[model samples]
Target: MQAVWKLSKYIKPYILFAIIAPVMMVIEVSMDLLQPTILQHIIDDGIAQTDTSYIVKMFGLMIATSVIGLIGGIGCSIYASRTAVNFSTDLRQDLYETITYFSNSSKDKFTLGKLVTNLTSDMEMLQRALTMLLKVFVRGPMMFIGAIVIVFITARELFPILLVVVPILAFCMYYFTALSGKLFHKVQKVVDMVNTKVQENLAGIRVIKAYNRKNHQIEQFTEVNTQLMKRSMAADQIIGVLAPLTMFVVNLGIVAALWMGAIKVDNNTLQVGVILAFINYLMMVMQGLMSSSMVLVQLARAIPSAGRIVEVLEENTDLTSPLKPEIKQIQGSISFENVSFSYLKETESVLKNISFHVNAGETVGIIGMTGSGKSTLVKMIPRLFDPDSGSVKIDGVPIGSYSLEHLRQSIGFSPQKATLFSKTIADNLRYGKSDATSEDIVQALQSANAKEFVDKLDAGTEHLLTQGATNLSGGQKQRLAMARSFIRKPSILILDDVTSAVDSISEKTIQRAIEEQFSDATKVIVSSKISSIRHADQILVMDDGKIAAQGTHEQLLQESILYQEMAKTQAEKGVTLSE
Candidate 1:
């Protein structure tokens, strides 16, 4: 509930519209409260006295009141809609910005499926909650209070009946709302599970089909789907009881009022018209209560959604720039001092007490077995995650002193998995350098040995790539991602196994381009293949979480057992230290 209240900040910008909506609702309810009184006058004075003129005047007044109420209700709806939409729009954008600022570990904390659910379904729930907050909560109590006041004017003794009926209805509403709330929390979690399964299936549909596991996938999906259905049914079933329960309570009050009214009517203590008005007032009060109860159930459901969204909104971005930042021009000199890191702080260090330095324009090669933290080491250069124990400096300045945008922009990074949006090849290539021309894109593609595939496409650089570059082969995607980094002309470029998917000939060509064309930039290549990095100015061999060896390739082969084994293995497979 507190998290739900936190969303009120989004409502502040639309406060005027929100205020006007409730005011309009107040007017509408007032009109509704006045209508029955007008009808009472038409019945008691006009009809009972047999005055057609009086009847016509009072009936016209009733028509006008109904029209006025209609207009007010429409205005309330328009303003509430505007307020709700604007609040949702602002909230969606802010949530995305929050996600973007999240630390790498923080992003991993909430997965793709949960974030997608929060942005889409959960946002919709909050929007609906906002709309109901403006409408039902206002009109319900107002109508109830106004009806009670109007009823008391002609039937004062009826207040005792209300004292009994109102408490019973209030208790029922609270009990049912509380019950629905706990059930709805489980319902939202079930929805997340269903969404997670859907994302898993869609992303791995090919794998599932390759293994002929579609039936098994369907069975898994059915199990989660049934959980969602059961939880949703349970929540809805509880909420469904409200309307009937409300009607029963209201009917009891109505029966009590009518029995008392009949006794009074027989004694000539109350007019027939006043008794009718009281009954109608009771019905309107009951209607407003029913509407309020339905709204309470919806609010109960939204509470869980609001809490999930707040979890993201309030997440601490673990990485933060220095308060007084330094702007240092990078010439690619990098140093890591007693650095240790872990994705989760409480977990074992992924990189332990690692110390390294590379001067400007040097080529460094990092080689390790799987899970030896090769990629994690390079990631620190771009400030993707701050080290847990020590400082990483670029050009003698601590990396955190520089803003994230400025720091990352200075480094060209090609990750292990290549990701491309649905855009033209030129667009993807120029993602890092938006103003790059076709010639620049072509040169980058050629440098990465990827221009051959681009040349084969009908539109060349203009050819449109499918989402995730589905049409491209694994090697092609890696090369294109490499080209994108190349077009940036970064001071530091890190390639993490970018050539793993390519053939030997293309891999050799890319390695050659790195030496010949990108020699001006500090190039750090992380690879499992010794042949790919054997000619580097310095090669680092990582074992466990520590740098086991660092030297020229020939130096490591002589002095390091891990390097000797790696070189021996690759040489026997027809790959050598140098051609």
Candidate 2:
């Protein structure tokens, strides 16, 4: 609940709506309070006196007040909805923006499922609670206080009954609210777990089916979902008891008021009309208590959600652009000086004391077995994950000295996975350069050896791809990813195993095209196949997390055992040694 209060600033933009809702609710509650007094007058002054005209006039007055209250209630509901919806919209937007700015390391701290739940379910809880608070929060206390004041003046003796009822209701409300808050927090955690399992199952549906693990996934989902259900039921049961307990206490107060009021009426000391009005006011007080409890329950649920949202909102991303970036231009040169990094500090470094330099216009090949830190080395160029120690520089400037946007804009990176969105072929190709012309798209696709197959489609570049481009073959997707980077015409291009899925002929064609098209661009190609990198200006053979050898293909064959062994292994596998 404290966390919920911290987010009240989000309501500032909708302050007008917030103000209007409570004000309207006050009007509605005022009318409600006035009704019991009006009914008292109708009974005592009109009906008891046998004045039909007075009765008609009083009934008409009651109808008019009812209409006014109805209007007020409607206004409150409309404005409250607007306030909650618009507030959540802005908050959700800011939360999403904050998440987008998170670096790879920061993102690793939260699961994809948890992030999605925060953006959706947690946000919805806050929105609903806000709406309830705006309406019921104002109405409840007004009804309670207004009814109490009226009862004290009209029927002072019956006020003692409220003394006992109010305190008892308050205690029950407080106790149940505290108990449910802890239970609801547990329920929300299980909901996050359930969502996580669902997300994993869906994202890896293909793999699950291929491996025949569908039953195992189903069992995992059921286990988490059952836990969610049980927690939800436990929280609801506590909240459920609250309403009945409140009603029971209110009904008991009503009975006590009736018994005492009948005695006073028979004794000719208290008016029957006044006793009826006192009972109505008592019910109004009870209504107020119920509304107050409802509001507290909503706050309890929203408290956990608000805390989760605030956690992300207040997170200080480890990666940020320098206040004043020193590097204004990039000439494609890259240098890593005595760099060492690990995903976790307790773990061994993924890249250990790595030092290298790539001049503008040079092609550097990085060859390593799996788990050799090949991908981690290239990722630092774009600052996806900053090095744990030492400095990586572009040109002569430290990478941190360049603004993140400017530095990344100067380089094009195609990862091994080749992620493509569900959009037209042209849309994905133009992702790197939004304003690319049709000819520019064609040239890039041609360079990546992808245009031939794309041209065969009836829609050609306008062809719509399915999500992850699953409709296309792996080789085709890889080529398109290369084309996306090529369209950028970046000063630095890093391709990690982009040609792995393509056939030998396509690989050679793509390699030749890259050399011819971006002759002056600094390119680092990571490949397992020796033939893919055999003709590079420099070749780095990575062993463990260190560069075991670095030289041109001919020089490495003569001097480096690792390079000679790699070449020999490829030769045995029927890969050509001659270029």
Candidate 3:
């Protein structure tokens, strides 16, 4: 209910339609109730006494009223559907906006599959609930109550049967609702598991095929499908029992009404017209109750779905910009003062008490074995994760004190894994600057040594890349990713082993381009190959999440044993070091 309440702000405008549709429903129901009275009059006053003209007039009036009611019902339905769709659209948009604000720490709490399910399947459930509630929830009860009133007016003696019948039917509805609520919650969980399994299988089809694990993958999917089927069957079984139980009670009430009404008519206490009207009212009441039961079943399904959406909406983001953060321009100087971090506090730190500085326009290189926290260290520069105990400063101000948007805009990052979207080359390069000209894109591609390959292609800059850039080779993808960062023209550029995919020639080409094209920008390069960072003005060797040595290449070769061993290993492997 809280989730619905929070969404009410977005949905409130359409609530006027909710109100209008129900009123129109009541009008239609009123017309239906009036038809039974008209029939009673036709039988008693017009036809019984042999007045043929009055009977014809009454019949024509009934037909006209029926037509009016039908038109009103149709209009109400159209209005309700339009409003419901717009309400759903607004709800989906809000959910997307909320998710976009989630920090990395908050995002880890949900899987991609589960989020997708919540946004689509869960929201659909809520939309169905809203549409049904507007169309039927109000009308069902109105018809039930109105029919009872009419039954009392036409034949008071048969009305007591409703007291006995209504409670029994209500109790059946209550019991089924309680059981179905629990079952539907389980159904949603099973659905999430199925979605997760399918998503994983599709995304990793290459690995599954390479290992020839088709049978294994099929078995895994079948398990989840079976679980979903079992839960759905259980819910259906509950509904199956409840539906017949309600019908049995309704049938018993009808038998009682007829038997009692017949005695009254024979005893001259009631006329045939009255008895017929009473029976008509009873059927209307039963139908209204049955429709109400269906609404309850749908509500049971939607409540849990709404709860899941609320959980994500209520999550707290660990990394939020300060209320009044500094908004100054970045000058490329960065400092880490005893910074330490861990993904989890109980585990060993991914980055230990590390301290370093890069003055304006300086090139600093970081080299370490895998798991030495090279990527983790650079991630903090953009505040991807806040340091545990110390401050990271940009331009002598603590990074946390800077606005998140301002800080990120000032630094260009190329991740260890080069990710590209399914778009044309021009679109991908222009991602850094939406208004970038073709010349800007050409220059960026040239700087990354990607211009030659891009120009040779049939479509050139307009060539469409497949998802994850699967159409391109590893080196081509890396170079394009590097071009994306280069076009940003940021004050600080952090490349996290981005050149590892390319050969030495291409690697040197990109390095030379960075040095010459952006002479004023400070660069931090993280690499595994010693040759990649040997020409850096200063190099830092990291071991076990801490810096083991820091100096120029020649100084490190002479002073650091680790650097010397790394250089010797590369020499023996026939990899030449940059002078």
Candidate 4:
């Protein structure tokens, strides 16, 4: 209910259509209820009088009223659909935008599959609920009450049967619905599991095939698919029971009504026409109750989805910008002051008391083993994760003081994973600068050593890359990612092992290009290869989340035992390092 209440904001824009839909539904219900009364008049007045002209007139009137009812139903459906569409579309758009602003903590809160479910399946269920609220929800109660009113007017003696039967029916409805409601949340959770399995399988299909795990993936999917079916059936089983339970109760009332009415007819106290109308009213009441239960069943299923959506909507963003942010002009200087961080709040820190400072336009290199927090250190500069203890300042201003947009725009960061979108080469490059000219793109490509291969392609800059840039070679993808950063021409550039997959020749080409083309920009490079950082202005060797050594190439080789061992190991492998 809270989720529905939160969703009501979306209905405000489409209020006219929302209002019109229910009014039209009421008109339809009223018209349908009037038919039983008209039938009574026709049977009692026209047929009983043996007047053919009167019977014909009554039939014509019935058809005309029936046509009007049909029109009202059609209007109701059309308008309800309009409101539902607008509501779902707006809510989905807003949900997606809300997800985009999620911080590191918020990202950790929901899995990709669950997030996808909330945006798609959950929103869809709420939309269906909205339509039901207008059509079945509004129509059912009105039909029930209207039927009761008609029976009271036409055959007051028969009303006692309803008193006996309605309670029994209501009890059945409550029992079944309560049992079904228990399974709704379980169904949604199982659906999330299925989605997660499918997502993992599709994304890792290459690895699955390489390892001959197709059978294993199939078995995994089967388990989740079976679980979903079992839970869905458990929930629907109660609704299935409600149908026959209500029918039995309503039919019993009909039999009782006929028995009593026949006794009255024999005594000349009741007409057959009135008795017929009374039985019809009882059946209508049964239908109304059944229809309402079906809507409630849908409501049961949608409630969990609503709650999940509300969970997402109400989640607090872990990272928030200050009300008054400083917008300073930056000069590429960088510093880390006693900074410490961990992915989890109470866990062991990944970067411990890290502190460093580099003047404007200086190129600093970070070299370390796999788990030494090399990537995590440079990430602080862009404020990807705020340090737990100390401040990371850019141009002497704490990075947090700047707006997220300005802070990110000031730095060009090429992450470890060289992600590329499914778009033309030119379009992907323009992500750095939406209005980048052809000359700007060409310069960036050449700087990243990607120009020669790109020119060889048939479309040149217009060549299309598939998702993850799977169509391109590892070297090509890395070069393209580097090119994207170069396109920005930012004051600060952080390349986190962006050239690891490239060949030695290409690696040297990239290293040389960055040193030459981006000399004015402060360059921070995190790599495992000593050759990649040996010529850097300053090399910081990290070991176990701490800076083990920092010095120039010659000074580090002489004084740092770690640097000596690394250089010795590379020499034994006969690997070339830049002199």
Candidate 5:
């Protein structure tokens, strides 16, 4: 609930709509309150006196009030909707922007599905609740208080019935709201789990089919979906009981009033018109109670949704540019001084105390077994994840001294897994350099050995890719991803196993093209194949988070036993540099 209040600023921009909605609701409620009094005049004054003209006048007044109330109701709804929708839109936009700027370490705290759920389902809940708050929230209390005042004035003797009924209804509302709050929170969490399962299965559909695990996937989805159903049913069942219970208590009070009024009429102490108007106001009170309960239920669901959203909104972006960044001329010289990093504080370091240097325009190759911290080492240079200890420097200055945007802009990184969006090939390529020309694209494609295949395509660069670029082969997507980085023509280029999917001939062609195109650019290539880095100026053999050996390929072949074993195994398998 407090978390919801923090987002009040989002409503500030729509304050005019916010103010107008409740004001319109007040007009509608006031008009509605005037109806029973008018009905009393028609019954008591006109009908009893047998004056046809008087009855017609009172009926006309009642019609006019209903018309006015209708306009007010429409106005309230329009303004309330505007406020809720705009508020949600603004908040969602800011949330998305915040996520885009999140550091790799910060992003790791949430799953892809969880973030999507927050952006969609969770945001929807808040929007609905805000709409209800502006409309029903204002209307309910006004109706309740207005009915109570009317009841006291018209039938003071019967008002005591409401005293007993109101307390009982309030208690019911309080108890059920407390119980349902916990249940609704659980329902939201289960919804997140359901969404997560769906997202994971969709993203890995090919893997599941290839592994012949469709039945397993279905069973997993069913389990999560069923959990969601059970939690949702539990929360809805509690809310369901509230309406019936409220109506029952209110009806009993109306019955009590009718019996007491009948006795009064028998004694000629109360007129029929007065009692009829009193009953109408009593029904109004019942409606008010129902509306109040609905608001409470909405608030219950909104509390958890708001808290989840706020958790992300208030998440201290663990990484940000310094207030005073020292921008310097970058020449691509890279250095790591005793750098060590671990994803978690208590976990083993992925990269242990490591020291290395690469001079400007040098090509360095990092070769290691799987899980040997090859990717982690290169990621540090771009400030994706700052090391827990020691510093990474570029051009003799600490990387932290440079703004993240400036530092990252100068470095071209092609990650191990190529990520492409659902867009035209030209659009995806331009993601590297927003204003890249057709000639630039062609040159980059040639450098990445992607030109031949792309030229054969019917649409060429205009080809629209499916989601995840699943329409292309793994090697083709990797080449396109490499071409995007190549288009940047960055001072320092890091290719993290980009050639793993390519055949030996294509891989060799790509290596040669890289040398031809990026002759002056510092390049760091990570690979498991020795042939991929055979012609490197320096090759680092990584063994369990530490650089086991660093030297030229031939030098490591003689000095490093790990490199020797790897080279001998590849040779025995008939994998050769010439091939």
Candidate 6:
């Protein structure tokens, strides 16, 4: 119900339509009631009294009322349908905008499948609900009340029967609503599980096939499918019982009305025409009840969906820019002061009491084994996540003090995994600097040692990379990623194991190009291989989550036992130690 209230802004324009639709429906119901009155007149006044002119006149008026009701009903339906579709469109747009505002931390709370379901299936449910609200919400109530009024006018004695039947029908509707609401909630949860399973299987299809686990994958899918079936059947079973129960109640009311009407006619207290009209009114009232009950079932399903959508829209962003801050130009000098960070407050810190400084034009290398938190340590410089304690500063200002857009623009990051989208090579590189020129792109490609491959392609920079860049080799994708970062020409650059897949010769070529082209830019290199960062001006050796040693390559090898052992191991593996 709160979710519906929040959506009122979207439906405000349709308030007039909502009003007019119900009014037209009431008019239609009144016209329907008049049909029995016309029949009464034809029997008692015109046909019975044998006056042909009276019958003809009453018949003409009946035709006119029917035509007017038809026109009004058609007009109401057209307007209501248009309003509902527009409301759904606006709601979808708002949902999309809310999703775009979610931070990386907030995004991790929901899966891709769940988000897709909220955007698609959940939205569809809301759309259907709006349609039903427009049609049944108005028509149901008007017909029920209108029929009741006509029945009272026909015979006041019959009113007592309605009191009993109406209350019973209402109680039955209430009970079914409570039952169906709980079942529908379970159904939505099962839908989310099914969506998650399908998404995981499709994304990991290659892994499944490589492990020869196709049968296991099928079994896993079957389990989720079975659960979904069970939930759906439970909901349907409830609905099945409700429909028959409602029909049974309406039929009983019809029998009661017929029995009482016979007694009244026999006692000379009621006319046959009045009895006939009362039965027609009774049937209309039952139909209205049935339609109203169906609306409740739809609401039961959509209410949970609306709650899910509202949950996302109402989430607070974990990362946000300063309300008002001065913009400062970057100078490439970065410092970390006792920086300690954790993904969760209750968990241990990933980086423990770390402190370092890199001056402009200096190349600082971070060498560590896997899971040493090298990437996490560098991510703070761009303010991707605030440290739990301590601070990161760039050019004499705390990173958090600057606007997020300005802070990130000062630094370029190339992640460990080389990712490319389904776009042209030029388009991907332009993502680094939206306004970069063609010459800037070429120079960046040369710096990454990717120009050779780019020149060989038929479309050169225009050649499109498909989704995930599946057609490209590992080394090629890494080079393209590097080229994208290089195009930014930022004051600071962070390369996270970018050359892991390249051969030693190509790695050396890329390293030389970086030194030549970006000699004035501060660089932070994270790599597991000793050879990769041996030439760095300063090397930080990390163990676990702490910096075990920090100094120039030669100084560390002489002073730190861990550095010495790592170099020795690499030398034994035939890795060159040349400078």
lDDT of each residue in 476-566, candidate 2, tens digit only = 9999999999999999999999988998899888988888889989999999888888888898888899999999988888998988888
lDDT of 4 by residue, 393-423 (tens): 9999988888888888889999898988999
Query: For model 1, what is the error of residue 491's alpha carbon versus the real structure, in angstroms, after optimal superposition?
Result: 0.2
lDDT on C-alpha atoms for all candidate structures: 0.89, 0.91, 0.87, 0.88, 0.90, 0.85
Better of 3 and 4 by lDDT: 4
Model 1 misplaced regions, further than 4 Å: 157-160
lDDT for position 510 in model 6: 86
Candidate number with the higher lDDT (1 or 5): 5
Tens digits of per-residue lDDT for model 5, 217-308: 99999999899899899899998998888888888987898899999988988878878888888888878877887888888888888888
Off by over 4 Å in 5: none
Score residue 298 of candidate 3 by CA lDDT.
88
What TM-score would every model get versus the actual structure? 0.94, 0.96, 0.94, 0.95, 0.96, 0.88
Better of 5 and 6 by TM-score: 5
Local accuracy of candidate 1 as per-residue lDDT tens digits, 290-348: 67876887888888888889999999887877777777788999999999998877889
- Model 4, stretches more than 4 Å misplaced? none
TM-score of 1: 0.94
The deviation in Å at residue 89 for candidate 4 is: 1.7
The model with the greater TM-score, 1 or 4, is 4
Residues forming the 10-long window of minimal summed lDDT in candidate 5: 104-113
Predicted structure 1: lDDT: 0.89
- Model 1 CA RMSD to the hidden true structure, in angstroms: 2.2
Q: What is the lDDT of residue 269 in candidate 4?
A: 91
**CA error at residue 60 for candidate 2, angstroms:** 2.0
